[model samples]
Target: MSDPLDKATSKAPATLGEGCLSRYDPDDLSSEDGTEFPGAAELWEQLQDTSDSPEEQASAAAQGRH
Candidate 1:
């Protein structure tokens, strides 16, 4: 309790899976984990709407190759 460095230390939540698939377990998360993202779906939809389709992007790239 007297060590100032110990007060600055933090720990991460438990994870599941391994390697690229590893992620924090949802069941172990709480409000303190900062997992809430109310705007995530809206942001995803906005991004999807603004981005070009794969076919359009491929065609644009093909034109530059000529």
Candidate 2:
């Protein structure tokens, strides 16, 4: 068995936020390059499949009665 203090020290240190890995001083940074991805929201909405066809939905309803 390990001591409580030893077990605590064996684990890694925690950061401030869930998604953040390291601290950032935004004032020290500058941006470069000009690559762009446009219409991302429109493309995502178009790609989603919300409903099935009328025939498929009707067939599914019929099968579920069993």
Candidate 3:
């Protein structure tokens, strides 16, 4: 290709639904697409243990402590 932009161009995987409900089609995704996150569950649990619930955060923010 003659244009440098051609090398930078990338396309998203196929999607499903429409509007706010739209999302990537899982069946079309692969590891090459960076879809794998092996530590996500562990990280989620760690975050859950360290962070307060939404209601608690809102209360802290309203009290000007957040």
Pick the TM-score winner: 3
Q: RMSD in angstroms, candidate 2?
A: 12.9
lDDT by residue (tens digit), candidate 1, 1-66: 497867776668899999999999999999998999999999997886559687876876798831
TM-score rank order: 3, 1, 2
What local lDDT does model 3 show for residue 64? 92
- Which segments of model 3 are wrong by more than 4 Å? 1-8, 53-66
Q: How accurate is candidate 2 locally (lDDT)?
A: 0.52
lDDT measured at residue 31 in model 3 versus the true structure, 0 to 100? 89
Model 1, position 59: C-alpha lDDT score = 79
lDDT by residue for model 2 over 15-34, one digit each (tens)? 34445557444444334322
Against the hidden reference, what TM-scores do the models get? 0.62, 0.23, 0.63
For model 1 the local lDDT of residue 61 reads 75
How well does candidate 1 score on lDDT at residue 39?
A: 100
C-alpha local distance difference test of each model: 0.83, 0.52, 0.88
Candidate 1 pairs with clashing backbones: none
